[model samples]
Target: MIFDSLDVSYGDMWGSHQGMTHPAPLSRAVAARRHAAGMEYAVLLSSRERPLALVESWPRGKWRVYLFDDRSWRMQMIDFKPHRTGMLLAHRNTRWQFSTERERSSFKWDVQETTTVLADGLVEMRTEFAGPRGASTQPLHARTSDRSSVGPEPVPVRLFPAPVEDFLCPAPEFGDWQVFAPFLAQQGHEPATTVVLNDVSVDEGSGPLRATEIEQLFSSGACDTPDGPAVVEPVDAGLLRITSGRLAVSDPGWIGEPRTVAVPPGEFLVTLSLLRTTYGVDVAAAKVTFSDIPPREWEMALRPDEDLGLLGEGEFYGVGVDTGTVAFMDATRAVIEDELDEDLFIPLDGRFTVELPGAESEPNLIAFRAGRGDGSYPVWIGRTDDGQVGCVVVDFQLHSSGAEE
Candidate 1:
C-alpha cells in the first residue's frame, strides 16, 4: 500500500537535528515553521507514488533541491542561491517557481546529480552524500498500492497556508497510521490520538473484522468522559453487541469498569478494547461470562487415604491439607490470601469428580492461586472413581511488570 507520508530524522555534526519527510501536504508547512525557528529540514514529496521533489533548507540562506520528472523518469539535484531579499521570501518564491514549472527545457538549476529508474509498482532509490565531516546514504522507497480500503486519500500539496489550529487535529490523510504517529511525536509534534480496537470476534462470525467496519456497522455519537468529550459507537455483530469509545485521559487516577453485555447460548465472544492517551496507551481484553449455562454435574472428591486438616478461615478457606504443604502455605498466607481474595474456596489438596470440557479424566486434582499480579490463576478439575469432584492447581507463575523498586 502507498503510505500517506514518511519521515526520517538524524543528528548532524553540529548536534542539530535534520529531518527528511515524504508525501505529506503539511510537510512543507511544517518545514517552513521549523526553518523560521532556525531548524534545518528537507521536505520530500511524490506524485503518483513517484519521487516528485525534495526541498532542503540548511545554514539558513542556502537551499538545495531535487526535482523528478515522472513522465521521463529523470531526476536532478541542484543548489539554488537565493535572491538578495530575506531568506524567507527567497525560500517561498523558489518553492513556488519550482512547483509551477511547465516545461522541462525551461528548468533553471545547477545540476549536481542525475539518474533514471524504471517506475515499477514500488521503487527504492538510494542517494549518497559526502562532506568534510563524513559520508552518509539516504534511501527513498515509495508504493502505489490501493488505499481506498483503509481510509481517505492524502490531502494534495497546496500553496495555500495550512491552518495552524488544525495541526493537532485528526486528518483523513493519517489513515490507519502505521508510521505517521510515532514519526510526528518524535519531532515533538503531538498529533491526535487514534484508538483502534482490533481482533474483535463475534459469536456469529468465524473470524475477526476490521475496526472501521465495526464502526460503520454501529451508530456513533459523542459522549462525556472524565477528561472531556469522546466519541462512542455501538457495534452489533449478530449475537453480540460492543460499545467502544475514543477519547483522551488527562487524569491517570480515573477508574472504570467493563460494561456487562448479554451473549446468546452456544456461542463465544473474544475481543480487545484499546485506549490511546497522550503519554501512552492502555489495552484490555473483554471478559464475557455466561449465567444461564448449567453447572457441570459432579461433587468434590477427597483422596481415599489423605486426612482432612483444619486451615484457618476468615473470608475463605480450603480442606485436605498435607502437613508439609500446610506449613508452606501458612508461612506465605498473607501474600497468598491477598491474591486469592476473589475465590470463595481455595483448594489446597483435593480433586473434583467432574469431567472438564478440554481435560482428561483423572483423580487427585489439586488447585491453587497461580501467576503474579497481572496473570491468571486457572483451576484444574478431574474425575474420581466414586463419581466425586476433585480439583487441583497444576502450575503457578509470577510475571514481572518491569517497574522500578
Candidate 2:
C-alpha cells in the first residue's frame, strides 16, 4: 500500500505524491511480491560505481525494494511484478511493453528507451516518455535479479527550522537640513521665483569662511534684522542666515560675486515665505528634529563628499556615483554571491533582502556609490540584520597602495 503520512516514520518518507506515476514493470513486480507466500529473502545489486538496488523478500512471497537511480533528476519509485525466472531480464521486458502503449491515447506519445547489460552482470534501463506540447518527459528504469549484494547504508537527511519572519533594515539616515536644505533650495530655484541680492561681502581674513567661524558669527549676534534677532549658520559649503521672523538667505556664497548685499525687508520676507512654503516645515524645528535621529553614513548615488583618512579605506572606484550602481571587488562577493542576478550584480535600492550569515534584522537603509569611474568599485552603508551598522568600502587602488613596489 502506498501511504502518504505527515509524520516522519521509521521507514523512508516521500514528501509529495504529486506528479508521481508508477514505473510499469518494477511496479508490477513489487505488486506480485506483495502476494507471494512464505518467501523471506534479501537481494543487493551493485555496479562499478555504487549500489543500485536493495531488495528484501518477505513471507507470502512479498518483497520490499529500495532502488536508487543516480541519473534521475528526482526520487521516484516503481512497482513491478515478480518474474518466475528471477533474472534481470524480467525488469527489462517490463520496460519494453510499457514504452509501446499508453493508457490514455488521445495524447500523442513519444518514447526513447535503452537497455544495457554491464560486464559485471548488472542491467541498466533508461526510458523517456513524452506527451502533448506542454507535457514533460517521464523517465523510468530499473533492474532486478536473484543474486544479492550488500550496498552502503543510506545517509540521513538533516532538516533546518523555517525562518520566523521577514526583516527590514531601517533606511540610512541622511544628514539633517545641512544636506537636505540645500537640495531642497536647489530644486526650488526657478526663473519666476528667483531672488537676487544686490551686494554682500564678509571679511574673514583670506581663503574661505570656515564652518566654525560662521557658526561663531551666528551665535555672537553679529547680524541683526528689523524683524527680530537674526543668525547666520554654516551648512555644507554655504551659510544660512535667518531672522526671528521671516527674512532668510540660503547658500550665501553660492553666487560668488556678492561681496555685500542689501536686502529690503519686504523682499526678504517674500523669499523666506517662499522657502517656508516649499519646505512645509519650520527650518529650525526640522533641523532640530532630524538632528536628534542620529546621522548615518548615507549619500545619494551622485554625491560622495565625505572624507576618509588613515582609519579606513575609500569606497570602490569603478562605477561613477551617478550610475546608481556599486560593485565590490572581492570584499562582499561571498556575502552577495548567491543573491546575484544574471549579470552577477545585486541592486542597491533595497528591493530585495539578502541573507548575511550572522544578520538578525534587516538594515533600515542601504546605499551604494562607485568610488571611481570604471564601474568596478563599490561603497555601501547599511544596518545588518544582526543589528550591526557601518559602511563597507572596497577599492583596488587602496589594496595596491600598501603593496611594495
Candidate 3:
C-alpha cells in the first residue's frame, strides 16, 4: 500500500535479512560493519517477523505517515497514544521507522539513554534515522489518563473533499426546490422525480454541465423574509397541490449530530435557506404533493342489439329497443384505463345523466334481462383522452301491468 517504497532498489552494500537475529557476543565487527555493545544496524529478535516491530532510536506514538520516495515521514499526528512505556531513538547511522503494524508488534525495542530537561522540566529525546541527522527530533511528554477531566467526544465534521483549495471543486450542499407542473410534466412516464441536494454546477452549451466559475452562494449566511421560508411555497401556480403540506426533507444529523431524513428524488423548486446571521440554520421540512385529476369523457360509440350479450369486452356503444324508439348515444371514452381504485371513484356529490333518446316505453323481461342471473351484467363501452377505457351497463325489467303490444 505504501507507494514510495514500492520501487526501492537495494544496493550491494545493503543486504536484507528476513527474520534474522544476531546473538550477543561482541565480535567487534561483522562483514564490513561493526557494532559496539549498544550499537546495532537492524534487529529481529521476536518469534515471528509479523506485527513486525522496528527498533529504531526514535519515540513511538499514534500517527499517520505517507511513504514518499524511500523515506517515511509523519504527515499528521493530532494526539498520539503510545501502547508501551518505552522511548524510540535512532541508531548511530542506520536507524529506520517501521510504519507497518506487521512490524510494530514483533520488534523488541530496549531502553536507551534518556535526556533530562533544564528549564521546561519536560524530558525529551533525540531520535536518528538513516544517518545521524537523517530524521527530525520532537519534544516528548509523559502520557497520562484523566477520567474525570474527559469532555464530550468531538463530533466528526466532514468536508466533501479534504484540504479544499481555490479553483478546486466547490463544497456541495442541498438546495430548496418547489413544485412546478410544467417541470413535473417533463417527468414523462417515469415516476415524478423529487428534488434533492446536488453539487453546484453550470450548464454548458454543449457536452455536459461544466463547473461554474462563480463562487459558492451559501457558504454561510441567514435571512428572514416577510413572505415565508425561501423553499416553502410552490414555485409554479400550474402545479396542483397533491398532499397539502405533509412532506419534509432533512440533512444527516439535522436533529442531533448524525440524523437522516427521507426525501423524494427529482428536479425541484428550491431556495437558499442557509443564513449567515443564524446559527446552524437548515432546511428541515419540505412539503410536496402529487397530481390527481378525475378522468374526463373522451369519445363514445353505439353497439347493435345483437352485441348486447357480448358485454365487458368492448365499450358500451349504445342501447336501443328493436321495435321501440332507438336511443342513440354520443360516445365518450374514460380518461384512465384502470378502474377507479377507491370508492371515491364515484365522486361525492358528483353525478352525470345519460339520456337514451329512444327506447321501449314499457319494461319487458326474458331476452331483456341484461344480467347473467348472478351479479355479472352487460355493459356499455367508452374511451378517454389517454386511451383509457370505461364501461356502463343497461338492464331491462318486465312490467306485468304494462304489457308490450
Candidate 4:
C-alpha cells in the first residue's frame, strides 16, 4: 500500500483500514507525501504551473483534489466544496484556518471552477483533499439480531476509560497576570468599532490619522524633541530587550517562529497611545521606538515578499491574534526554521496584571490584550525623512472616535 493503509483483519481483537490516514500538517512525512502528490499533478500540467494541483475520484460524492500556486497560476481563494471537507492545509503553517464569503454559500456548484490565487503565499489556502478514515482503535459496536445471543454475552471486557476532558492549558491565573495585564486590558474593544490606520507613506488623514499628528498627540504637556512634540511614556513595567538586531511584532504565542526586521541591538521602549472614547478606553496604537530620532515617514511593515500594494486603501497585512493578545519581541527568540509554527483565562477587568512580582528585568516579550478579542492586526514602520527607522507601530484601529481637532 503506497501511502495507503491495508485493511488487514486479524479476527476480533485487531483490524485495519484500507487506504487511510490522518493529517499531520506539520509532520515531515506528511509534507513529503503531499508534495509528492502535488508533483504528480505538476507533471500532468506538462510542467506548467496551474491552480488545480491534483485530483482523485472515488465512489459518488468523493472527488478529492489539491490546489497550489505555480508560475502561471495563483489563487487568492478557491470556492470549493465545503460539505465534504476532508482536510485543509494553508500556506506554510500546519495549524491554519480559513474565513470565507459571507453573502454566498456552499461550493457554488460546479465540479470544476476557476478561482484566483493570492500568489503571495502567506494568506493562501494551498491544499485540501479527501479525508481518510483510519482504522478504529477498538472493535466496531454491533447489535445481535437474535435476541437469544444476549443471554450469554461475552464477559464485558473493559475497553478504555472515558475520555479525559481536555483543556490542556487553563487560562493563566489573574495573580499570574503581570501588573501590565490590567493596564493593557483597560483599553478595550469599546464602542464596538474599528478604525483603519493608514500607512505612514499614504498619510491622507489630515486631522488625526496623520503621523505628524502622532508626535503631537500629547499636545499641551508633551516632551519637546528635535523633530516635534512628543508624549513619550516609558514602559516602566518592562522593555523589549533586543539581542538580535531584528525587531518582531507578532502575537506572543508565535514568538518561537519569529519573523523579524534588522535593527541595532539594544533595549527599546514600547509606547501605547491610550484614549478615552465615547464608549470606553481604547489602545489607539502600540509603538516600539528604536532610537530617539524622529520618524519622517511610515510604511506598512510586513514579511518580505508580502506586497503592501495588494492591500486596498484601508486593508493591511496583519498577524494573527489567537489569544486576544499580541506582542513585540526580539527577532532571535524565534528559532523555528520552516517547521511553521493567552488570555490569562478570566478577565480580572479592574484587577492588576502585566507586572509579574519580582520580575524586574527587561522582558524578551510584552504581550497585551488585542482589540476586542482574537483576530488580526497590522504593524507599521516609521522612518526618518532620511530613511532611518524611528519606530514600529501596531495600530489596532480602535480609535474611531477621532480626537478633537
Error of 3 at 214 (Å): 30
What tens-digit string does per-residue lDDT give for candidate 1 at 196-276? 312111122111111111211112454333434444333211111112211110001111211111222222221222222
Candidate 3 similarity to native, TM-score: 0.14
lDDT of 2 by residue, 101-187 (tens): 243233243543443333344555666555454544443221133224354222222233322111111111111101111111112
What does candidate 3's lDDT look like per residue over 216-248, in tens digits? 222232223332323221122111111212112
Give the worst 10-residue stretch by lDDT in candidate 2: 266-275
| RMSD of each predicted structure | 25.9, 33.1, 34.8, 21.8
Q: Return whichever of 1 and 2 wins on TM-score.
A: 1
lDDT of predicted model 4 = 0.38
Q: Which sections of candidate 2 miss by over 4 Å?
A: 1-51, 56-128, 131-405
Return the TM-score for candidate 1, rounded to 2 decimals: 0.18
TM-score of each: 0.18, 0.14, 0.14, 0.41
Better of 3 and 4 by lDDT: 4
**Ten-residue region with minimum lDDT total, candidate 4:** 9-18
Task: State model 3's lDDT.
Answer: 0.20
Query: Ranking by lDDT, best first?
Result: 4, 1, 2, 3
Residues 1-405, model 4: lDDT tens digits: 011111111100011111112111112222223233321101011111121222222222222223323221212221222122332221121111223322112222111222222333223222231111232122123222443333332322322222222101122111111211111111221111222211112222221123335554322343433323334332332567777677877765555544466777777776666544444444446777887888877766667765433322243457677756666776645423242222332422542124211134433665555655676666667787778778887766553322222
